[model samples]
Target chain A: MGEIWPLFPAAIFLSFFFLLVLIELFTISLTKTNVFPTLEPAVEILKNGEFHNALLNTLAFVAIGTPLELFAGLFAALLVYNSYWGKSFVRTIFVIPFAFPGLVIATLLFILFDSQGGFANHLFQGQYWLFPKIIDHDVAWRGSKYLALSVSMLGKVWRDMPISMLIILSGLNSIEPELIDAAKTMGAGFRVRLQRIILPLIFPAMTTVLLLRSVEMWKEFIFPYILAGNYPLLGTLIEKLYGFGSDPGEAAVVALVLVGLTILTLVVIVEITGRIKRVLVNSGVNSK
Target chain B: MSYIDRDEIGKRIVWAICVIVMIIGIIAPIYLLIKYSISDPSTMNTGGRPIPLWPNRPTFDIFLYLFRDREFWGVVSNSAIIATLTVLLTSLLSIPAGYVLARYNFPLKRFFLILLISVRLFPDISSVIPIATFFVRANLHSSFISVVLAHTLLSLPYVIFMATTAFEFVPKDIEEQARVIGANRVTIFTRILVPMVFPSLIAGAIYTFLLSWDEFIFAHFLLDTGGQIQTLTLYLNKNLSFSPPQNVLAAISVCLSVPVMVFTFVVQRYMVSGVVSGAVK
Candidate 1:
């Protein structure tokens, strides 16, 4: 027992709060307006149109945002992977995004994407001479649900890209340089080395990024709440229900669903990544 | 040109372009933020004239306005008070727990560690409702006490994780020597073990401070109804709802962000380890 006294405070504090949260969450979800325990809140939420919309919107957000983050991260990692002048400088720049508060980033995106003469609209509408006209009109970024959600996803991806980059960069650093040099000496080109050697080696890092980023996307609130308030994700829906709608039962239900989706994403990613890694390893051995 | 020379040149060009794009992507937004913060009314309200890339007449009037505003100071003080309390409480709870976890071998140690870390994996939004509900029922909602406790709960795991690593990094021989020298466990812990891990513990404390400072969901939920107290995050969110002038929002955002950004750059070396520790483990 090594003197159980030291760990007691933190253990009790954590467990008490966690158990309280779990019990309260379920308790609120199963009841409405001081009614006895019932499934009405969950049932009603499941049958609501807004809930469905938020669910579908959240799925789209995750589907688009997660992979976008992976690609953005992978791009940044590969950019700084090779030895180059000012490598640390470039790495610092990539990390700067993560340094900013998410609220600040969302606010900045709000300013730049504002409907009336926003920077993005000006640039895309060909007001800026350096860039060709991508659009004929100043686009109201939050004009439609899809547009609003897209902007939210863009902000989310931009803010979180650094986390993915750092994770992938650490994975890249763990690859021994000699392995790549050996491949090159054996007449393997960049493409071949990337596909065969580098990709499989960093698959776990990519998987980690995917799993973490998807969970993040599923629970994303600030960006959507700020940039796309008209449309709701599961995260923002919880806020709307609890704060404005005054429906704690329904809010708790949505919160539970968000937690469920996060766990489900975690499981699905782990299983798929595990299977894929096995296949990749077996194929690599067979090919050799 | 030789084949190698041509290939090298092509690669350099691509690398330069990519680097330029990345730099622009990161810097442009920040520049726009600063620009808006400094922009005069003429620059912001141009009557549909395309806003200049540079503000026509930049000024720090909004910054001065915020500095002079009592309400802004109140919000700033609230955020500072909450963040400081969270750091103190989280560190106090976590340091000893982390020390024990680092040094002692006990039954169910793995179980305890997972229990601590798994608490982090729960979605903050999902967890906040129940917590907020509890606070309201206890008549503690909107008080500094509830917000500090909530923020401490949010950051306790990371501090514990960081503190454990900090304590683990200290060589065991020093502790053993102290014990052999007739020093009590408390004396050795306060005198030897803690001093050795002080730097890393400070890092853990800073991390806790940042988490509490940047926290929003709990602060917003707990304090929204009371309307008596507001943190910087809630202030910004409330201002955003009323569609305040962009310059004011930018200035407030700058105030809220500068400390975090400065600390991040100053402690850039510890960042990777800290980030990886929280995420991967």
Candidate 2:
């Protein structure tokens, strides 16, 4: 129905220009190692002890952060949705964290919880004296290796909770009020209404949020770099390899692996999304 | 009547508690920056640390220091220039391409869609090194333009995808009616289609600009032209190493984020709707 000429050039550009990235990936990875894009890099990484720590750190991040973000977002949405007055202002406040740059969040939170004379230490200074040896004094959360990693994970959760709430809130809003009323009329308790009516309706939204969060966490470098000092995630590892190690091949290997993981997850989401739409439509029809 | 009144009271209490918790959780962290940005320098690193919760001697000296610093202004200008160019170029490229995807049936369209989606999957960290090397060889590295182009690569896919959705929402009949009235394709697109999708256009531009603004990895490698070409993110990381004065760092952090927070507050609904359409729906 539309002219082909103008759009054709854009398509060709899409096809061609994107290849430059792929070609660059292949050529750079091979030129240095004289091996395949991932082969030597994978072998070297597996041999390195930090690789396991990075992998474990990444998994811990996703496992702890994803659920915490989702639960907090869901509860926040439910509260806002159920509230009466000033809904718009509440939504505005909910989104404030999304506005912060990653470095800003990491740095500010670091200062907020600084070990000596920081907020946590000052607030808990009384508790420390009252319960000596039982109450551990506010340790430098971002200094210890494991604790630093966990605090950075908390930072990710804090910032990302807003977008997740927004997405889930929209989905929750789309559901018919009549459906929930019907459940209540059927003598369903509050938990039953939520479990039977709300959760299924919002599953697709959760999937979208979770997938986006996972992809983001996979490439999460800035927070860890800013908050955790010398801690290495897969992302910071890429930086160290290229900038410090001067091994673009190894860095390419790490980068491509992350890409591979992301693409694989995305493919699964695509397959599931088709079924989800069908399920929602069929459920609505069957109920009628 | 009594039961309903009690139920209403319970719900109000829950809402009140939720608001309180959210305000404390989100605001308290930001308050840290405000606290340190005005903390007295004498109380920092020299003698016993002042109570960070409440700075006894608060002053705006740090803000004055950064404002006077030449390098801070350079990073600020660099960020503004790159983010501005990114918004303009992303819109120019994405709108037409999105319209095409929405209106026309082209061969390999699904293939192209998947290809575009695949671009989003790959992190910039993965490809930035190779891209940087390629750009350097072409003598394009270490410049504001290089950073803009690199950011566009990350921004374009999301913009194009969102733009396609935005175009689809503009009722087909409006465009069809325009076509029947002797309007050519360009006129119809620019005047009719563009106006209808204006909110989405704004949202897409905001997203693209923010994406470029916050991106640090690509800026790190691509704009390696000494200290002059660094973005705000690079500036922060560069200063982070020196263990710069806490108040100065806090001021820098606040400077980088206040604009973003203001933008988010203004366009909150548009952002939420855009995500719903693009991500879930």
Candidate 3:
């Protein structure tokens, strides 16, 4: 009722967070070292191999991971959306991967991709359940940067795709069945129905999923930090600089980069959600 | 979920294939985790030219062995205590905060909203440094209190979002009806709105609990004391270096994930609803 119940608690937490960030920022460049760490050094720092790899690695992660997850999620949503039988049953179990902590998934996959007796390489050994020479030798998945980073992404996709499924499903519920029926009567087959009707209708929700997923991938630290070892992404780089290397200055620069990316994504989310809300209104879904 | 007819053989075929692929995807990691946990730690040479997909021999003794490790249990308890406290504290603060956010508009409301969103989305990498420094300065560094406070900051932002959405779900007419009955805001809140959104609030709490339970960054930096302060997550990561036996590691991982896995399964619908409400709105 009063401002105190919510405002006070929020103020306390926000102040703490802001205070930490401010302190790190000032100490990093403005106070201790240089005048705002001009764009030149920032660019140079970025151009360096270490940061270049991290940035490339992170972008690669977002680029490959987001669409893959969306398709997988949309596929799952399609299966569960219309199925009335045991809907809850499928959902409850299917979300098992969704329920795990990213750290735990990272750990499990880290070992699962182990070189010796690790399933990532060993699972498809001789029998070749799917294909021959699919995985013949023990590839040390976490040994190198690319394999480790990509394998870690598999874990992230598993944990997050179900969420994409849920959001898309919620959006699915908003679509009028009459439209689908009309489309069907017009000689639309399943593929056409999916491409013409379902895809366009669920596009905003899909946008929402991608936006959130992008935000998550932007801040992704645990998966890479744990599974990929010292190789840094934007997420793990800040941690490495601040925590491991003890260089708050470089850490601040990277932190600012992440902050900038996050803010941009947040603005995009606001815009997308605004679009979704307008869509919902236009379609007479929520209306209120 | 599509609306295609159930009797459509073609659609059913696609549906079954997609579901099977998804099921296989979901089961892959879990199957491996369980396989390692139950299998013998040493070599498995089954009819033997190459590695088998599963163990030649599986046993539950790894779990029994893990239960005997007092250090593991200690860290597990630390994880529980912190996560439990985080859930309670986060819910307590989030409820009223959520209520105010849903209903009221005050000075600096826009700023606060922006701040809340940023805080929720901000990577822990940046904020963790200065916060950890401040805690260190206060001499509360690496303590349970420091770790819990750090975790509260992480959970609070999103919990407030979750809470705000939950409160928004309560119809305004309901609150107005209570007002018509001569109820005060506090009475209406605790008596009416609370009950209506209690499940969502609980869902939010469980989420917060799981976050702290699974959190590593804060626990890693904050818990400087090795044996006493380490949470299960930190323990898991630390053990990664020591090269513990595979079964033991798997058992511990299973132990860490089981609570969250079970809780999500039990409250599957509520959690999904909570997510949709928060995200879509």
Candidate 4:
């Protein structure tokens, strides 16, 4: 007993994890919803290639959305890098969305894009009136899976872009003014200076932002759940596994898959990036 | 050349565009939410675009309704109680823990540090099931204590991270000076270290409070019995989902976010420096 006392903390931690798994199982039974209905059915779904399709959709969303957001953030940062009038206010305004809870943003978007009498409809039909034909048409943003996914992406971009912006802003701040000055003296334009100098110097920060945002987007739940409604991302799927009326076994499988995927991605990114960084540093040193 | 003047004008124009985009993307949406809160409930169902810039008839009926509702007050109290307790418990545990980690070279310190960082990185979904079940088995489910415990899990990591950074910045020479005067460890900690890091500690405390205040997942899952331990976020979610009148729901959301905004406004300076110091350093 005395000898085993040291293992108490470990035991407690394991028990806590076990308890979580148990609750997950209970919720699955309680929910009665299944991610993979049966082993055979899941196999059939895989064979039918819906699983592959879903996987592709998830990957595509991450691939496209992540880079777009990162670029948008960088662009915004660069636009606001110089100390200008109202810069602080702009920064504060941009960060407000981040501070507001995800749930609120999701709900607000829902209100704005509702098919009937929504702001989108009003805008299309009113002042601009360019899309008159489209304005008359009932566009069910929430009903269509594609539309739902798009809204989810938009919400994520809105919430997450600021994070990247903050990161890039800090990175921009760290870059030496001499480099920019030298480039300008050599008759380089703003675009030339940005492409050649700013981008390379901020690559490390960009990598960090990319990694963090990707991981965050992968695990994001509430916004996607609320916005996409029926459409399930991996996060939403895991959530459903734990939600009432979910099938525990299938949910467990999904949860395990998610954990595995996340670990795999993190490992791959870290290893690849670490190697690349080492190579770059070594090459620079050898050149010097 | 005049081309350079044109380029500067272009840059200013782009900056203006960026500011406008930000206002539309970030400010307008929040403004709409606030606007919806004051709009009459009757107008919500009419399905007009509800020009949020200025409502035709603005009223505080929704706010009045929310304030008058006992359940709303209950949720507010629950949120306050839980956030306060979480802040207190987290600060108490994390300050000393962070101090030890920062100042001392304990055995397995690196491993512990790794564990802390790993826990912070672990997605909340991975731990939610186990944490919830543990609470249930312990007969702490759906209670304020369980909620506080859950919040502590979320808040502790940040607290420790922030507090440790603060602790590290406290001059070691001061502690040595205290020791030379025959001051005990406790005295050194309370009198010397505490005062030095008081601002940072307060900043951390405020952050923890905000975290607990905003945390929804565990609170939503753990608190089953309605009105027993419903937080502001939970209450807002419940009301939002239950098809409460849009104005009322919006009002509740506004109320819910008000505290966070106020807190941010109050602690923005301290938080900015604290986060920059701890994270960017």
Candidate 5:
């Protein structure tokens, strides 16, 4: 027992890894239906197939969301890069949404878009009237799968774009003024200077933020759970399996898929961003 | 100053428009939340426009209701306790581990760093079932300690990840100087190393605090009984039934967001740099 005491921490670490592996095995082996009959029919639900779909959804979401955020963020950062009157305040306001809890952000959208008394209906019709007679006639936001997905995307963008902006802003700050001055001396215009200098130098920072944000958006649960309602994002699918009560087999299957897709996404990001030589050269030029 | 420079003005104008659109898109909903929180509940329920640009019949009733409600206070206290404890415990475990990772040449060090980063990327949902099961078996569900431990799991990796950078930034020469001055390793760490890395530590603490305070999944999954261990987010989710008074809910949301907002505002300058530094390799 005394000798075993020394091995306790290692044992705990091993157990944690064991639990993760066990979840992966269960997720891969079981039929989704047999694992979670209440959530979905066992006959049509192939664990392997659903796993693939979730992987696809995760990849698609990341692919769509990350570049979108980066472009938007970089544009905003460049716009605000040169100090202007009230720029600090503008930066502060931009960051407010990020400070609000994800659940609050989701609920705010839900309140704004939920087919009943939603602000979207009012805005679309250009009326300030509350409880407009036309709200019920509008399609429910959560009822339509595509609309639900769009709203999820919008909510996520609103919350996360500021994060990307902040990252790019710092990267912008680190670029030395002499480079800009040298470019201006060379008769390069604004677009040329940006394309030739700023873009290359900031690419590494941009890629890092992109990878982080992609991982975050892929794993996101709260916004989709609230805004998407019953639409089956990977996060929600896992939740449904767990909610069905003691369906460890199916839940494990979902978990394994989640982990595998996350690793794949990470690997892809590393590969794409691995070519840092161009960025390093640009950074060196700016430093000099 | 010349006609040729008019192009610059045009560019600035375009930039202004873009910035305004981005700000409006991000800030409008949050502004509406604040507006709704202050709007009269009666006006809200009566289907009135309720002053879109300004508060009409603004009242402190919502804030009063939140303060007076036992459930609200209970959840706030629970959130505070859990968040604070999670930050404390996460730092305790992570700082030493981070120091080791930053300074040591241990075997599997690179692998461990990769593992930590990957774990951060792994979705919380993936581990929910097994962790939940473990909690149930241990009979720790709905307990404050359980939630704190759960939050620690979510927070520890980031703390270590951030702190490693923070520790690495402290110049080795300074530590060597301290040692030459007869300061012990512990003294050098507390007196020199900690003060230098204080900003990163604070940023890490704030991040962990916010993460725990806003966490909903584990709190929802683990806490079953009312009044047992309801964090603020859990309370908000639980109260999101049909016809929850918008003003009251908004008030609660405002209350929940204020600390983070204030923290961000206070550290506004350092926060951005700190985050970018920690995250962007």
Candidate 6:
């Protein structure tokens, strides 16, 4: 104990702030509507139509964005899995999107998807001779709720691709070359090798990607805040409640809900992945 | 007879397509951003013509304008000050704690470790209001002190993790040798252990600096009332809310991002591990 006094500083700093935040969140949220403790704040926010919409939007964001991000990362890792000339340079380039701040990426998307004369709109309208016209008129990227949220998801997924890529790339690199070589020697096709060997081996990395990316998607605030101001995901909803609505109680309630959803998603992912692993193992035994 | 392996040909073809797609998908947006920054009015507001891929007359007017702007410089300096202070604060708190954790087997060590990592589980957006409210109530809101503290809290876990790994890498024999030479604990910690772990600590510091520099949610809430304090992120957000000219926005975005981009390339190796560590453990 005498020798461990050095740990006190960091321990106190973290624990102090940690308790302060939890206490503050709970106190304000419960005491908002009554002098005594109550669940009114939670009830009020939960019953609101806006909260429901935001909840659904957040669910959709996590559902679509997490899997898409994992696939994007897996795609990138597979692309560079084989050694080639300029491989290091290509890998560095893949990280460029993530190197930029989230806010910067969202702002760039805002400009590019600007309803009128934006580059994307111009391209789709066939202003460029290199590609045929896909749409005759300009499409408003943020004109509707779906379109707005889609733009936000696009920005979120684009900016975060590198995180998943790095995780999965490391996973891919861990695969012993001898395994692949043996598969090739046995006349296993590329598709079979991928389906049977590589995919199963990289399952852990994919699980990591899913876990981390889902949490990120749930807490995504900047993209939707910037790109789809009219539409509120649960994250941006917290900002809106406190910033514009000036209701800290409601905001705290939403924040708590966001945290709950994140934990739930994590649990569900773990269980699902565990079940799949068991099924895969059982099938392999049956086939043998 | 001419025969080719279809699998070999198929792999090459797919790889080629992927390389092209990856290059264009990543590079095109960045190109547009730069073009927008330097673009002249005619190129931006073509009024109905297809906007040219390249700017009609590229100029440095926006960059020059920003360089000469006092407010822009203020925001830049504010971000620098807060980020520097965060790195300092986080290092001071994390190094001793990390060293202790790496070397000692204290009671409740497992609990402390879990507590440290789980501190990061709270979403920044959710946590910001409470932190901001506390600061405001304490009359520290809008001050650099509160923002720096919040940033340190946010980045401490990663730095601590990095520092622990760093200290663990320094063999225990060196410390034992120092003790045998009659050196005390403090002397060995400062003269031997710290020096050996200095490079990794610097890596941790760089990571902390970037985290603080790129932080927004906490800063936004803490500095919300004080119109005087603006980080680069807030400056960009404010400009965007009011519909600034495309070039000015792009220039500001470029300025804000250049430091992060530069450090990223330099510390890419450390960053890969730092990123994974933050998520996995």
Most lDDT-accurate candidate: 1
Q: Report the alpha-carbon TM-score of model 6 versus the true structure.
A: 0.96
Better of 3 and 5 by TM-score: 3
Off by over 4 Å in 5: A1-60, A128-139, A269-288, B46-51, B171-183, B224-227, B268-281
Question: What tens-digit string does per-residue lDDT give for candidate 3 at B1-281?
Answer: 34455557666676677777778878877887888888874444333244455776778887887788898789989999999888887887788888888888787778778888666666787677667767777888878888888888888888888888888877688878779989997898888888878778888888888889888888887884342588998888888889777777788889989998877755655754533333222
lDDT of 1 by residue, A1-288 (tens): 647688888999899898988899999999898996999999999999999999999999998899999999999999999636889889988888888889999988888899987888878877776888898887889988988999888888988899999999999999999999999899887789999989899999999999999989998999999999989999999999998999999999999999988999899999999999999989988988
Label model 4 with its docking quality class: acceptable
lDDT of 4 by residue, B57-143 (tens): 899988897799999899899999999999988887787777876777755667666656655565666566556656777988888
Model 1 CA lDDT for position B132: 91
Ranking of models by TM-score: 1, 6, 2, 4, 3, 5
TM-score of every candidate relative to the true structure? 0.97, 0.87, 0.85, 0.86, 0.83, 0.96
Model 5 lDDT per residue over A1-288, tens place: 332232234224434644554564454335453543343433224544654565565566677877888887787777678645678777777767788888888777777775755557656544654434543345678888678877887888878878898999999999999999999998998889887788887877798788778778778788878877566678777777667544556665666667777778778888867756555676678988
Candidate 1, residues B1-281, lDDT tens digits: the string is 89989988888889889989988988888999999999998888877667887889889999999999999999999999999999889988999999999988888789888888778787889999999989888999989999999998999988898889888777777778778889999999998778777777777888888888888888998897856999999999889988889999999889989989977765655544422232211
Q: Model 4: per-residue lDDT, tens digit, A248-276?
A: 44444454555667777778777877887
lDDT of 4 at A177: 95
Scoring the B chain of model 4 against the true B chain gives a TM-score of: 0.91
Tens digits of per-residue lDDT for model 2, B104-170:
8878678878878766556878878777878888888888777887888888888888899988876
| Per-candidate DockQ vs. reference | 0.71, 0.47, 0.46, 0.34, 0.35, 0.71
> What's model 1's overall lDDT?
0.88
DockQ of 6: 0.71
For model 6, which pairs clash? none
| Regions of model 6 farther than 4 Å from truth | B5-7, B269-281
Regarding TM-score, does 1 or 5 come out ahead?
A: 1
Please report how far candidate 1 places residue A137 from its true position, in Å: 2.0
Docking class of 1: medium
Score residue A184 of candidate 4 by CA lDDT.
Answer: 92
